[model samples]
Target: MSNKAGSFLRNLGQFSPLDPRSRTLRLYPLKFSRPKISHSNWNLRNLLLNDFDNGIRTSIRYLFQDPFILKSGDGSLQRKGISIATFLRVDRHHCPRRLSFDSKHSLVSAPPFDDGLKKVNVNPEVSGGAGLSKEINPPPISYRKLSQECNSLSDVLDIFSNAPTFPSSTYFSAMWTIAKRMSEDQKRFEKQLMFGHPAFSQLCDQMMKETRIMYYDHLLFSLYAMVKLGVPQNTLVVQTSLRMVQERINECDERCLSVLSILLKEMDKCKNVDVLKAGLRILVHQQVWKIESIFTLQTVMKCIGKDTSIALKKKLEMKALKELDRFSLLNSQHMFEALAAMNHRSVALLNECSKKVIDNIHGCPFKILVSILRSCRELQYYNLDLCKGIADYVATTFDIWNLKQILLFLISFENLRFRPTDLMDLLMKKVVEKPESLNMRNIIFILYVYSSLNHTDKCQHKEFLEVMSSALTGCLHHISSENLLKAMYSFCIMNYFPLAPLNQLLQKEIINKLLTSGDTEKNVSRLHILDVCLKLDKVAYQHAIDLQLPLPPPSLSLSHSKVAQVLSSLLGGEEYFARNVQLPNNYHIDFEIRMDANRSQAFLFSEADVTSTNLRRVAVLCVPRSLYCLDLSHPRGFLAMKMRHLDVMGFHVILVKNWLMEKLKMEDASMFLKTKIYSVEAHPTTDVNLHNTY
Candidate 1:
């Protein structure tokens, strides 16, 4: 059985050396009359007839047309160890002296240089290599090796040409590797490399011009590399660069020039915004032009509209009217529009232009005024008249939201000297007149404005809450309960900032609104409530401890739900304050006044005696005090704990009654309190012993 198994395995190995599907068979050993390995060139016919077996000859003919190797001049077979030139030199010497060479490989062959002849001085000192020996002629360098280095350079350029759209770190890595190899002595090619060459300015310009929209990042990276490689920013190079870019700007693809023009202008000005804006004006041809050009006219008018200066206003009107006269343009609508919007020296220009255009029945001058207003709005150049112009446009268009945003913008602007109350009134009228159109964000914004402008000592101002709630409930149709709740929370927090009428009652009502409107989801309402709780808890604790404010009235306990919810969230969590915190011996405490009249309680635990057994606790009682005093004289009192009351009164109260043994239990605590005889306001040393109790 073992012999049979071995034979079966050996048979499987028999045909494994050659692929069965291949028609060609190997002709390993040829039978020839001359030594089979002799150095000679023989035809296929001769080899087939005299050397190969019949089956091998047929396979060899099918696989290849010419399968023989040439012999050396020494009549020895050329193999791996023979140098190529030696084989060539020796093989030529073996050919018959009389035979004419007709082979293609030998057609271009030249006689080898003579060793006896002294070389010419043309290349006697090759600059890069060591001096050559006079005794021996150096072998000609290989084309094959030079070709390989050329192939590597080609590969580097190919990689650069096909760079991925969004370059990854790996792409940069590959580039750095290729750059290292090609730029072995990189400084040598700094003048020739495309990225380092002045000629590359044209390439960049061509790319940006060819595409309608440039990937600004790619252009920036390329330009950054060029600048880093010491591309000089002189008059000639800069002009050349600008000329290339100007060609693109001429083609009207402004986006391509967006980053490019910014670079060129700011590069000279060293990142100055003013210089960049000036450069943009030049790039867009926003300068003096033939008075016939409407674009130039419009741009000049727009710039003048955006400027607030009274002096500059007169100057701009003079410039525009002069340009209008240059074309002898009689009362064109464009000229009339520009005249109407000018702040100085344009009333006559306006009357003339408006009369002609009106005679021609173009009464829609407000359209032009609105366009001017919109442009100046973003530039923040609006005044009362401009605001009125915008309001008039709003009245016509009924764009209440746009009007609100514009009003909000005006309200938020820092440098505006005009009164905004009138504008606010206008917006409120719009809101009241069209309730369905107003969204909650607008109403909130209005309220935010009210809060910003009206924070003063006047307590009679209606609570913003009622206004906000009414607007929210009545005007806003699509508001979700959850967002409404969160908005309320945010509003309450904002309210805390201004010293407004705040009380436990108001806070309780706010909390009720929050929880009632919030989603029950842990994320939705719970997190928001917790946020409010953390804020309020700090306020509550501070008021209780620092201001010595009384515990908030139990009637003002709408916040209880929120507090309970937060407590439930914090259960078993390390985030809560623990009773066992290793507190300092002389711990300092501070309190800050927050929302309404609430304050914050803060504990400052410093260096501690970790091994100490007794802990000190200070508890405060009462509301922010209208009266207070400090007592340093205390001989009889044990100075049990520092205590403060609502009147800012400090007391060195002696906790003379240690934990009553029965007080540890609830029933005992109740009985002890009921039995102890106490005064309404007892001094610290006034020891009232409970031994006289019934």
Candidate 2:
């Protein structure tokens, strides 16, 4: 070994195990060459001192550079090569523990690093002693990870509370994700947080600002959240947001249209008509000619009331018509309702809609079909081919519709004057199947339609009658007074007499209700009661069966002296005509005249008894002033409607105006009646009979 290396190894022998500082130093055996005989002349004391000084310098540098070491100023230590006793004294004050290394694994483990910095005081008189106060400051937490891993609303809220500022888009995305995964209880909790908390208002403000750049799905989610949060459509924030969307409608595609449609629908529910109109104006300006756009337009127009200007309504109608070819059944139904509400009719549009409805009848739902049918009825635009197709579809799929739908369908059929026996049979079969579902409305509608179509004979199905009678009896108290009168009127028209039990129930419930009521101004109700009593009396008298009900009072008669005088002057004399004459169908008229005045009795003919050859009778209707002024289009104007019944029953009708009788001299009145009734060319045989009567 070289002399310097041998001297360095010999200095390690001075340290003894019993010394307290000796345990801090760890030594390893070194293998050295014994002969560096050429360099063996070096001084052992000088080399040993130099080697010890180098070792001390290296230890001091390592200790200063260690990350775990605390430095007071400039990171400098005094007396670099201090004595071993001084080093041991300094280590006891600063370094509490020593580090150790494993030779086999080559790993080093140090004492735990103290990140808590202790404060030291320099003044000794003011402070009792040097105080060590440690302050802890942990690293900041990652909010991004918290947002992703959060499972409950509370966790998310806690994260939001801790975060000073977060990306609004990212926060909303996380919220929606959490909402979608939440259970019912969790959803309720979230609703509380979103609706009741102030943070949501800030979030909404952020959303409004960021909506322009936000993704379409994100925007939709934000809108849905706002709706579920019960944000009023008329609120400034909601209005501003909707207006912003409206301003950008030109860039919108079908997805935007869908969202806008939903928004307008909600606004409509809130009755925000001004906003709806504004949105509609924007939509129209964009000219987004799509079926969905048309539907939106129709919905808005309906809510805007029928007072919309003609020009704008016409423009919208033209737009809707232009897109009719692509409309679904629902679209067509909406368009029809809108047009009908606005009192606008486009025959071409209606025809196209009906064609589409017929094409899609099988896939169309019952509600849509009913709406279409009702529109057709209201507009009086009946397409025979369409009605036939609908009737066929309904007949084949009878069981799929509810009782109300089927009843409406039947009314539609009667209105269109289109009736199929099979469809009627199918309806009867349904009534028999679920009789319990039938209510008073259903029974009343069935009777009205059958009577209107002159098909009341078909209602005599034993099972159907039984079920319907029972349903009517059960719902007797629930039926309104107006509807009960209508039902009685319909029964009188159809000549349908229910079995004894239903007859007794109708007598006690409907008749007694009408008679005992103290409401004196119910003129219409009293008239209906009188008509029902007259028809029932005729029925019982003709059938020779007693219903045990008293006849109506004579004061209830509809005949007026003014009407009788007008008719008598027009019909030549009172002897030539019969007053209050009853027809074969139990419908009474003011006057009926025989072909020959010598014939004492006026002819009473059934529907089957009437023929063009045997139409030898002439009926005179002395309309009251009130009845004469009623609009023929109204269903309650029976005077105008009775003319049609008279024509169908093979009688040539003469309408004597009672107003003329009251206002004019008898000569002018007779002259006016002759011009209105007897001026027309008549059948030769009927002409002779009429000439003889006059």
Local distance difference test, each candidate:
0.33, 0.51
Model 1 is weakest, by summed lDDT over 10 consecutive residues, at 623-632
TM-score of each: 0.26, 0.50
- Poorest stretch of ten by lDDT in candidate 2: 86-95
* Candidate 2 per-residue C-alpha lDDT over 498-599 given as tens digits, one digit per residue, 9 for 90 to 100: 444334435545555555564524524434433444444445533322223344333224665765676576555666556777765445677666542222
Give each prediction's root-mean-square deviation over alpha carbons. 30.9, 27.3
Pull out the clashing pairs in model 2: 1-33, 1-34, 1-35
lDDT of 1 by residue, 442-499 (tens): 6655554443333212332334444445556563357544444444444443333221
Off by over 4 Å in 1: 1-294, 297-318, 324-386, 396-440, 449-467, 470-694
lDDT of 1: 0.33
Q: How well does candidate 1 score on lDDT at residue 55?
A: 18
Top model number, TM-score? 2
